[model samples]
Target: MNANEVLLDAFGRIHEAVAATLQGIDGDSLSRRPAGTGNSIAWLIWHLSRVEDAQVASAGGLDQVWTSQGFAGRFDLPLSQRDTGYGHSSSQVDAVQARPELLLDYYDAVHRQTVEYLQTLGDDDFDRVVDTRWDPPVTLGVRLVSTVADCLQHVGQAAYAKGLGRKPD
Candidate 1:
């Protein structure tokens, strides 16, 4: 498979895992924090979506789907339009309460944008430097991989939190 195809497949898995992890979860459960620490499932999902939206938009030189698509308004989050849940405090995490559907909708929107952006990139585009702050700088390929890694981590956290919220059968 080509690079684009590989990225599409990896991103597709993330989308599928998101839906599976959130399936049948109620709003209260989605927002529940395990042992009242760390992030809730809702926060994790939202943060993942936000990070993807922000980074993909930057890589594509396009507006973030969050603000452009009115997701910021739809969420009405206490945080600013620029917030991506980075270094969010416990109280900030607790503030991100939403139903599974909303979380999924936002994620779906961001994922769509990411796919569209990826479709526009040539293999050479991935080698373009997108960040210079790192010691070796960072390429589009590295940025995309990092975004995927972060999303996977958060999704796994969400899955674990979902399991914790479940009552013993």
Candidate 2:
């Protein structure tokens, strides 16, 4: 398979996991914090989606779905427009409250935008650097792969939290 196809499949897995984990979850379950301290299912999914949205948008030189597509207003969280849940505190995590439908809607929107941007890239595009802040710089391909890994991790945590039901309070 080609680079683009690999990325598509990777992102598809994230969406599948999210859908499976949130299939029958109610609002209370979604916002419940694991062990009463960890990230909630809602926060995990929302943060991952936000990160993906920002990363893909930056790579494509496009507007983030969170702001351009109206997700920021829809989410209505008490965080900055550019906040992606990085370094978020417990209060910030609790601020993100949503039902499964809203979470899915936002994630699906960002995913569609990401897929469209990725489909426009060719093999050669992967070699193009997208960031210079790192010591060796970052390539479009590396950034995308990093984003996939991060999203999978967060989604996995959400799935575990959903299944654990050990201390979601």
Candidate 3:
């Protein structure tokens, strides 16, 4: 009924959706760009995880799970260590090839990290500013909410891409 509990529920949904979306999907299908130009399902999920990892880590003043947990090295794409898939080009999207389990494992690590971070916060903690780059500055609460929205949106896109039911190559 409290803020943390509510956040836990929302984040729990993300975990479930992620597991469902990636289930049984292989790497080629994951990386397939719809019509050969759109964001691949792989890229969407990866970006979603990256955004959550980056924002949550910043809000918590902790290290990103991507680097700290060796995901950057494991993924091993020829991208910057700080790459979050934001504004990545088509070729950049193509560079993010990953197996389903690898993506799921990375997402699971980031999700667990996010859960741990959320568990320690009180309602007042959400009011703390986490980013000051924006016009109004970003608070922990806004950052978390934005992350939830962005995550769900990307996951939904992934699901829809899957539903397009293009024959797996």
User: Which structure among the candidates has the greatest lDDT?
Assistant: 2
| Candidate 1 local lDDT, 26-94, one digit each (tens) | 988888899889699999999999998999899789899899999999999999999999989888999
TM-score: model 1 vs. ground truth: 0.97
Cα deviation in Å at residue 25, candidate 1? 0.7
lDDT of 2 by residue, 38-152 (tens): 9999999999999999999998899998999898998888999999999998899999998899899999999999889989989999999999999799999999999999999
Model 3 CA deviation exceeding 4 Å by range: 166-169
15-116 per-residue lDDT for model 3 (tens digits): 899899999887777987888898999899999999999989878989999999999999998999898998999899998888889899999999999999
Total backbone collisions, model 3: 0
Error of 2 at 14 (Å): 0.6
**After aligning candidate 2 to the native by TM-score, how far in Å is the CA of 68 from where it should be?**
0.9
Return the clash pairs for model 1, or none: none
Clashes of each: 0, 0, 0
Worst-scoring 10-residue span by lDDT in model 2: 160-169
